[model samples]
Target: MAYECLFTSPRCVFFTFTLLNQLLPSILGATYHSHDVTSDTVCNRYHKRELQVYMSDPVILETRPESAHMLTLGLSLSCTFEMEAKGFYTTGVVSVVQSMNFRSHGDNCLDYMQTIYEDEDNDMKLKRKKSKKKKILKKVVKAAVLSRRRRDTDDEDGRGPRICGRVLFGLQVDENETLPPPFADPLPPTKPDQGVLSSLFWDAPNPYQSLVSDAAEVDHKGEIKTRLHISNRMLRQNEDVNLKVVYTAYQECDGRRVPESLFHCGYGLCISRSLVNDGLVNCPFGDCADEVDCASAKEANIIAKVLHYERTDETSVWWIILWVLVGLVLMFLACCGGIFLFMRRRKH
Candidate 1:
């Protein structure tokens, strides 16, 4: 007998697995050496195929800027995707877009023109003869008029316009199979300063900061959706910016529940909240549990004492009854000894 399973989704890749089973009837009194012979054979035959077809049609669909017009420097964007399998995946995308460099231009262009004209007039009077004074004055007047007209045309409200420059936007996605990173995985280790362009602009507090790293999860239907919130300080007015999203997909077979604290042991293991500060080494490495969570030896000792007391409380009543029975038996023996003494005295 043969069986075929088909999985499909829109904007998602589909994977198909085929299994073949052949069972033979046993004769009377025949002995079977292995119970898993058929299953083992089937697995051996299809293992490579299963791995090859596991992920198919994985793609990033759209990368779009959230707004076309921004008064400040902040920017926002979103990336949507479809994947073949549900698992852990990671991707880094970067976009280079134009933004206004407000610091490059002065507020008043008229003041700047006046300073240039006065300096030029003083230099010309000192260098020129009387015969050439009229010609020099005519040339200066013509040049000043042209400069004023150009400045007026450029600055409509008497303030100079801002200059534009290219800005780099970056986003990183790290996702888990069962739960989102916030719930399933520990906070990633702090990154070192590698002197890359992205690292130079990665600011923690500023939303319009050039680089951002985030995590996301693929849904059951093999899709991932996420948004990036940008600061108004990162953008220019009515500017169109480019966006790009890159990604990679893989699978995780371990079936471990993520703890509330979301700490991981680095080797695909989750650290239990109960085990933290309990003195016992739950994580394979000290750093995996985080230095702050595992810092105090006194906390672990206190936790151990509390656990011991809890166990003692559970059996306290039984222990009390046993001790009372022993005490009563000793009392009965004493009474018997006293009665024997009195009987001996009376006999005498």
Candidate 2:
């Protein structure tokens, strides 16, 4: 009966660990509690761990003081889970849900997580044949029932909203950091809006009391799905590793309700959220604004180190340059001496 009540009620949220007390970016000032899920906890048939959800509080995005020009109107959640796949099932799914007390009007929400590594059995991906095949797929969005679709699903029955999406991350943990060094991928940017603002209406005069009276009729919550598949080849029957899970939120009202998620390249330009770490160089070629700290980039660095192909230190580089210069000077002098001898012999 308690399980049934938890599913039926909106106020009672689920978490693996204790609550996280922190202030998230809001259109108006608001606070949120963090929740967690792990492999050991059982919730549903489709997922291995229970859903990590943000407490039912409307975090109104407001204009940050430093960036007064940018008024934020939506919230984002990032969840980190310690993953060990020894005795547990070889495959599992990790889920995170973002429920809103107010109505959300667009498809601006997307999910991302740490990258999983795939390579040959020798050591790591250090010595795979050079091929164009991608080792890991970082974007995990299999099936998502967002704002509108979720509302319709809830109407049919009093049951909780059905939320499902793509597998999050697939990993193989070993004693050695042989597992691909985990890194966060940037969430894709939302499409540009028409620069207009939509009117957001709420009931109670106090922003806090504006929470929807009926939990079943709520329309603005979404679930992010990710998967972890452990391989017997990589683990030693009782090994576990830690991985990161990230969730990004965007609100695409007609006007700029929330600022577009952008990542600063540390250079002069700010690129779209999707552009960051998408593989193709969007910012300056070597600035590494979009490429550095990415999963693929970090993995490549690790592979290079393992293969003994990493770049040499600056001192070694300068020494090589000096040797080349000295060699060039000696060759030039030898050529001059040979020309002088040839002229003298011809005259004689």
Q: How high is the lDDT of residue 254 in model 1?
A: 29
Which portions of model 1 miss their true places by more than 4 Å?
Answer: 1-57, 62-212, 215-223, 227-238, 253-348
Model 2 lDDT tens row, 1-348: 464333333343222111211122222221221122222231123533323222212111111133211112222223222222111111111122212111111432132222111111364334333322422211111111122132333233223232222211212223232323322553223332212211121110111011211111111222222333221222223432222222222222222232354444321223335434433222221223345632454333211000011112112344367556755764565566567667777999
- lDDT, residue 346, model 2: 100
Assess the local accuracy of residue 69 in candidate 2 as a C-alpha lDDT between 0 and 100: 16
Residue-level lDDT of model 1, residues 1-348, one tens digit each, is 011111112111111111110011011111111111112211133231111102211222122232233323443221111223322231211111111111112352111101011212365565544546356545654444344332233333222222122211111211211211222445333322323322322111111111221111222122222222222345444643333222223222222544453344333333223334433322322221422333332134423111111211322364368556755764565566657667777999
Error of 2 at 328 (Å): 86
Give all TM-scores, in the order shown: 0.18, 0.22
RMSD to the true structure for each prediction, in A, is 34.0, 29.1
lDDT of model number 1: 0.26
Question: How high is the CA lDDT of each candidate model?
Answer: 0.26, 0.26
lDDT of 2: 0.26
Ten residues in sequence with the least summed lDDT for candidate 1: 17-26
Query: What stretches of model 2 exceed 4 Å from their correct place?
Result: 1-221, 231-234, 237-240, 253-348
